[model samples]
Target: MEADKVKEACAVVAMRCKQDVAQYIYYALRALQHRGQEASGIAVYSGGLKVKKGVGLVSDVMGPEDMDKLSGKVGIGHNYYSIKVSRPENIQPQSLKTGIGDIAIAHNGIIVNSQLIIAQLKKEGKLFLLESEEEAFIMRLTDTIRATDDIAKSIKTVCKELIGSYAFALLVNDRVFAIRDPYGIRPLCLGKLPDGKGFIAASESVALDVLGAEFIRDVMPGEAVEITEDGFKSINIGASINRAHCFFEWVYFARADSVIDGMSVYEARKRIGWRLAKEAPAIADVVMPIPDSGRAHAYGYALGSGIKMNEGLMKNRYIHRTFIMPTQDAREISVREKMNPVRAVVEGKRVVIVDDSIVRGTTMKKIVKMLRDAGATEVHVRIGSPPLISPCYLGIDMTNRDQFIADHRSIDDIRKEIGSDSLAYITIEGLVEALNFEKENLCLGCVTGEYPVNIPGERRRFQQTLEGFT
Candidate 1:
């Protein structure tokens, strides 16, 4: 994994000259590296777009020397470890031909009923070299746009046929365009560089921040935005009211500094801890977060619960994120090397470990083991969100259902396996309440299974019942 970029998934793009296109692309990617780390690639559309893509980082896959090699006024880039297609062949910036012209695409999010769409495309006898769910989406959009001549209309029609979440961007015939899914399950923020030479299409605003781009508003749900030499235009195609931003972004994925819907992720998480304290009050002597993202949540939990927040765990900041590790052995080693218990705070006292979520139960088990080894009397585990039983086809790599312990196991069953004295997951209902159900902007697909948008990938894995659990 690349040392500096921590993201495991995402895409970034911008337009114009003055500043080096390839160079700026690299800078944008470094900020978005959190979205994907498996592979990084970039494409530039100067005279006739030149593209470079492979399995590596923005720095590793692209260098200052390489940046000089690519000369394009309009460019789009992606940092991906394709969650839907796992196969390297199935990933992005696909250069395809339509009756209109040649188009290059970069996409974030998933196509829900991909199989159905692919079957239809197959019946039409479209020769597809890349069968990834993403490729199919590009093919569909191109086919529609070619016949319509109106880009927005074509996108609107394509969106109607689409079934899942997505934030799609494309470098089409020297122009760039982006589209957010009807529900906006994934994030797509637009920003302008300090010079106003171009606009950025990014998964998170944090990337925009890094580039000194003014924070442009998030691409609204069901909106299609096009950027050309002339200017930019936005069009809406789907129901605005049903828009559901992925709640997981707040619980775990998003950077703390980002503001979504005008709310800071750190602030939202702190509120989550405060709510958790009220909903599941415990008499623990001290409140300790599991480290990393849980820190802010821990602060809120401590303040709300009136428990003394302690640095019970000593985090070895030098170690990289274990989740980005490609091998199990590497991950295990990273986790152990990165975390250790502070005996001064943990010995002979019951401790509460607040974490984002419990997936396969392996990480939690290992953490519990560490707590016990440190001489803790009892360890209670509290997850900031409910179990993640569904695979996140949109962007996250939580694909394999077999890897999800919550899908097949009960809460009690998971508690026993993790070896925690007690375990409590935040209620889904509580999640809605915390958000004040203020508007129709939150996506609870992972927790509720009722995607505001359709998800065809659900059947690609397991078929378990999590409805009654919440």
Candidate 2:
């Protein structure tokens, strides 16, 4: 429940239209600001490709004057969040000039085989300009296939060599290319503008909504799409594998209004709450949410439990996501500054607090104490997702096993630690059922510890060393 519960990966948006699309991409990235806040960039192609990028929020990086400089009809945008220190080179829409053309790419997930690809490229006498794994991997792959005239063939070769999760958008001169990982570990969707003159691809449906585009459908797992003046053409460039869409998208990462892989995130979360109410019913006077992420789940819980939903907490709109803050103390302070209990609603009430998940339990304990200080007689906590017991290797920030409260503690121990009168979590089975998708299609890696992709032993050890757990 701490502010650093789970960090999100990057976001990608690409537009191919008759008119200039730099502004469209700018607005779409703003809609997806929740996905990443560390850095933002955009690449547009008119007569030639132009890109503007910096280390900050979208508004901070791109002012009116900045947007005026990037003029193009086809463009790609990226929003990045790094577990490591953010730097200017790490900022993406990473571009390279090759014999074929200038290539710009924006990526949204981790490439597990990046080291292997980098080494191979090195053996081939190639040099990498960017330090980020995505930039290195993409640039090397582009270099490998620079001789090919067909962009689709180049992308297919790249997809064949890479392993792990990713969804990327590429800008090649006047064309745009989009590809989702074989397992669809990340979300990507295609849409059309109101006049049907342009095509949009983004990390979430909500981005398309902001552009007044009609959602066409999700790009199938392992599929590659190329948008040009001719039309949108797609090919299955990846191997046929079981879909392992990141389940956390519905649980925590996505905007409530977004839909991923045919599942409505808001609807999925509401179902999670509905199922939680049935499975872990807590006796209380009122049902309340933690605000924001907990809102939809709390509404579903209230409906299922036949309890009135009340606004027991008010959030400060000015406060940014605490997880992005620099230090633990800063994040803790953010929690206090972000929300305050409504004494009139919680005073002398047996309140049932519905939340999405509890990671470290640091913020949850503080929240319970805050409610108690404001006169709540009882605080019953219900988490929509099952206990997180393992680290996520596919771009989520929960890579350190020691940071998980559930990793070493029992459910009862967590409840006592958080000072909740009672605590319950939805079962893994219940969560999968609520999603209403094939059970195998969901990656419950954090909950189940069974990763869909094979994690190389060396990489695992390296990650442990980085976390100081070795």
Candidate 3:
């Protein structure tokens, strides 16, 4: 019952500027805080790398006194959402001294083959200070740096050893390096601060918008960029033969106000709703959203169906996102406190409820019962994205096959489970069309169960393997 739709890995932000950038990084982290809330950390290089991290919200972890001490013109920050929150050392913007120089790294996606690399390192008598994927990343990078004696070459070598999605922002002394995986399964972008004083690279363009920075462009897939106060430089190692940009970003993970990879997240979501309206129009008296998550999609659904849309649920803004809550009990309690049904609007009305997607069916089940209790005559559910039938290995938190309601259930079964009068979801082709992406260029792995990269024991969309660099 702990299925809160979907959750992403974390957010990474790095900056190099003429003036102290610790404050700016803090603000940017606030803007991207929705991406993670488990832990917050910042690493800055002021003659030396200084790091302050703790398990909590950004506001709880980094106070004014803390920021005053993190004096540096170049720094990186991370907002982490970890399933294993007991390990405080696993929190990131993980900094360590390397043979080349002091380096701090922040990561935004999963490294599927990290265990293999870690095993190889341990076999070679290498020891680790932390037990996490980012730890494995830094160890491997330092090992390669010891051989190549070149930061750029070491980064390229490390990229080859990784077998899954990653968007890394590395702080090397006073420089910042931004790197994206070959498939670009996650989003990362470059931006410029006003007056040419600095440059920023972050997981989303919304970070740039908060800092009044100009978005340069998306960091290309398989590219590594070097940034300093003066400017930035980039080198493309090898773009993937097939692009697998995660379509879920538009559906759920990203802020609706943000734009990613040339597509507006809000627009894509609305378009998905439009598609859903045409494919699964409900014969209802009114259309209403499940609250903020479904608002944009509901707008498009209303527009397409020519049905009046009304706010039938009032969200409790103070409630933390139920999906990111640590435990099943916490998630269930959160669902109870997160939203309330508007009895006046739904009373005696057949309500068509729009939502992004349904994962566990527990949350939806509770919501449907609430609506019924509040006098909604009929509760029909329309989903913007296709049913999630597989777990995401790239960066999302749906790791177990049994957690998905659609993994083994049909539409009618799900409808019965959620106590909905009817249920329908957007088709995969409709999702691609709404996102305005060619099917081959998008990662529909969670829905289709065919990933772009070669994951052992799972189906791959292509024959490409993570080889050559090893």
Candidate 4:
């Protein structure tokens, strides 16, 4: 039932600097604010680990007074998007006192085998304070540290037991540890600060860019990096036999400016748009994007199809993204407030609307209706990514099979459901080609119904299974 609790897809950033790391992390979190908006926090090591977390946006949770108190040269920050109601206890940099030292962790991605691990730990007489996967992770790591007596070895042992995606930033005493899952299903990168002041590891390169840090490279899959004021070192936790990087990162989750796994996200999206145009060209007068995330994709489509690109829908700057809302009702209601049609651009025009992807189709349906109401002669939809037929067990919120509009539905059927003149999604092969990665290297779980990681009751591309963990 991991799918039933789809409460993840967060951002994590860690910094080890000579100056106060908290303020830099604040700016980094602001850059990564798009990743998660429900909650934000930062844990710094002053005399010890000092944590400030709350259930609100980064700016709302941490003001000048809040940042003034966080005095440290090394720290970690998190931006969380919870599919469940926001609670203070669930906000992370989830910390614990281990046998090694004071440990605090901020993680991005979902743990599919967490329930099994939690059950096993319960039988061992370990008590949990909260119903959260971060608590479970802390408990498991605590046990592993107790047995191994080494931080690096402990992380390796925990990685073997974990059967899902994760990109973690851990503060153990004064040093920081950055770890990525074996499949690299989530994005994590390393960066060097100006004047060789410090090192950083974040969920995206954009986080580093905001702080004027130099992007070094992505953390290798199954690699654990230990960073201190002196420097940093990388340790191979496990060999990534079948590296399955999440494809959705480039499609929608990550900021368009980010370069994930060495591929420019903006370039990949634009290429996907070009490919989509080639695969499903529309005879529309003006091509318009859904705004924000869709701008790059729509631009590529316009380039490929030799059509002019226009902004038909203007996004409200204050509205939170509807896709990450906790409930369907909230998502549906937010869509109305999130966008408004430009009557001059869309009216009496044959419009081709380009978007990154469609999950439940409610947003797209509302958008199509909004365009028609604005006097659009016709609204055709062109998705930059392939149709989602399966739930994402790695990190995305589309966990239920029934939540996908393309699930067991044809293209024409989806067109009718969304009330669009036409609908087409990029092909899987086209998407892979556009990303410039081998099809085997990308995690197309939601698109192909086959995951790279071992999820219970799910089809895995590899032979790995979660039976042993259970």
Candidate 5:
């Protein structure tokens, strides 16, 4: 499943009261839903942070009818995508007890070297129950912070001792704070309200824009921002060498209009498509994109190949969830609803289909069959990404090794399975180059399996990663 900007924790905290704070939080979460769709939760702290979470979209998690009931002047929300933990129960805004008091924490991103931290805690007789390391983080921090009265200071100290990727928010007592890991593997941003009585913390600036809040600068890597009565203040936890950003976030996962680190995702994708055309030129009557993810790359491919890019297929915007679902049948159904070949454009023409990545062959097979049904003379499949051969330990939904198209079959086999006349993926080096990103700065674990951290012995901890929305 594609993880979007929704995973970063969202919150609206104010010492003073606002009657429409819950509505405001709902709008904020809706904008951030692109980050995670699997599970969603909201914890509101008017006096006590009451939490409600379920598996699905924000509308489903907190339905339109239910929004009024969830209204609060102070609140935090979480949208979950199962990157490391597939079970919906692990989806967050998790409430837990510590030695000092009880705290509610919601997090986006991964904790690298999580297994080591878990093991160390276990050796010291700490009980472990949560599947995600994010939950483990709550327990670890709770225990550590019990030694201090200042929650922000405790978070800074505890985060300094940990390793891995993260953009997180915590509701301890009446205040809220957001933190970004040193490596900045994921994105988190802050927003300001019109009256300055409330603030929001989210994965993308798009969320803030949706909430009608002014965009503040991003929560800097290795930094923490506190949302309190004073409005907001920052704390620096220091930085490290591993500032590796996930290139795919811009390539396919992120919304095209969203920007990261002052770079436009849509433009970057067009750049990749343009680079693809230069590197892998193919003769085709028209260039076809694999519906949603491939559009940007297809545009790029068109610009570079000097070939006309046409809408060879139309997609149903209301396609069912295909990313995290467990069955191939569901995915097949989604492909049916999501895309259909345009015979008028493709008939008797040599078609070049461009896509962002190939996770499994099932969806592509049906798509190719659709094109054939539309009377395409020749279909050449070109992928914009390198072959994925390993599982991602970071916060992505692709946790199963067996489900990957690249892991299970050779190129020829995949081509045969998809029923394409020819199939070519962007080489690993080419993909890295196309992204125009530094290899040393990327967690290419999925493409190369050279994970920056160690894997846990609990192998089945994450499987059927495509389940819910985000």
Candidate 6:
């Protein structure tokens, strides 16, 4: 709940409809606004692609006049959160012109081998105009489209040559294509518009819900879906191995109202809370969440622990998420500005504070201080997920392992660092059990230090050097 939590990579939404789709894409982006907030953009194909994008919130970037200008029947939208520097040109849906027509792409997740692909494309005389990796990767698709007339085949060809996680919605003129990586390290779902006049694909089903679209199913790992006037068609272009969906999608990234791969995210969080209560119960007078993300888990914890759940913290709905703030100092300030402890609920009481996960511990320390200052006798911190001991190279930006308190300190040490009377984390086994899935089906790389995809030895060495564990 602190501003120092893990940050989501991005969110993507694409729709092919009979009427103008700019408005629909706009609303869909708003629904997915929680996934990313740094920048937002939309590209629509009326005759050729028309793009309107900027560096700001969705409402700030796309006003009524801007939406009116992006009129089209087929379109794609993007919400971006930059782990590095924020640049205007990096704002997607990144577009390019090709001999056949205009192509635009909006993507979520990191493309690990983008540099290698960029080098290869340069050798082929392909020029890249944008500085963002997603833009350069889209240019590679342009080359493929030039080589092959078929869009799906081109995506399949280029996908085979690439590594790492990605979920993409691309618009080539009027046709819309949605592709998920081989491993499905990110989430993407397909849906049908009302009256069956259109199709929709997005990073989560909540986008489809906002548009009154019927939930169809998830875009299988390694699959590409093409939406044309005829309907929806798909092809499997992913790896032949087992899927490794990101576990964090259930733990923190997704909206509680959304479902991913037949699993309800809210139900998953509730199960985590119930299991945590059984695995690591805290004797407290009241069980309360840190607001927003921890609410559902806290409910489950309260239910399983036979304690009353109360709103002990009031969150400022207007403030940006602290984890996405540009600087540590800004994040620190936002931690105080974002939430306030309800003195009436926690005063003179032993409080159990439920949170999704802890990353840097800086914000958690501040949160505990806020509770103590509000007259809580004792604050016991309960995390719904296991301690994040490693970095996530797939998409969610916890890349700097040195920032992970659990990686450097034990539970007792972390308790002292965060200034909590007591602290506990959901065990890895409990987390897997709560998901009700086979251990191999989920990517627990951040907790276990075992990645499904192979990282180059040099990259591993660099991470170790940065963590000072080399």
lDDT of each: 0.73, 0.84, 0.87, 0.85, 0.71, 0.85
lDDT digits (tens) for residues 381-470 of candidate 6: 999989999888888878867989999689999999999999999999999999987776788888888876667642321122212211
Tens-digit per-residue lDDT, 1-470, candidate 1: 12211133566565554555777778888887767766777788766768787776667787777788787777888887654435666556667665676677777766767888889999999878867666676688788876877777877887778776777777776777777877677788887878656777777888888888888688887788886544458877764454577788877777788776566888888888888888777778788987776887788789889988998877777766346578877866776777778888998888888877777777678888888888888888887887877666566666556667788788899999999988888888776666554434576755655555445433221222323111
Candidate 2 structure quality by residue, lDDT tens digits, 353-423: 99999888888998999999999999999999999988888888888778988987888999999999999
lDDT of 4: 0.85
* Steric clashes per prediction: 8, 1, 0, 0, 17, 2
Candidate 6 colliding pairs? 3-323, 222-238
Q: Model 6 has how many clashing residue pairs?
A: 2
Which of the predicted structures, 3 or 6, would earn the higher lDDT when compared with the native? 3
- Which candidate would rank higher by lDDT, 4 or 5? 4
Stretches of candidate 4 off by over 4 Å are 1-8, 321-337, 464-470
Candidate 2 wrong stretches, greater than 4 Å: 321-334, 458-470
Query: In model 2, how large is the Cα lDDT of residue 143?
Result: 65
Highest TM-score: give the candidate number: 3
Arranged by lDDT, best first: 3, 4, 6, 2, 1, 5
Tell me how far the alpha carbon of residue 55 in candidate 2 is from the true structure, in angstroms, after superposition: 1.4
**Model 3 lDDT tens row, 339-359:** 888889989999999999888
Q: How far is candidate 3 from the true structure (C-alpha RMSD, Å)?
A: 2.7
Each prediction's TM-score versus the true structure: 0.87, 0.93, 0.95, 0.92, 0.84, 0.92
**Superior by lDDT: candidate 2 or candidate 5:** 2
What is the per-residue lDDT of model 5 for residues 155-272, given as tens digits with 9 covering 90 to 100? 8778866765677777775667788887577777777777765677777777777767787777777788887554568988765554567666777766787777666788888877
Higher-lDDT candidate among 5 and 6?
A: 6
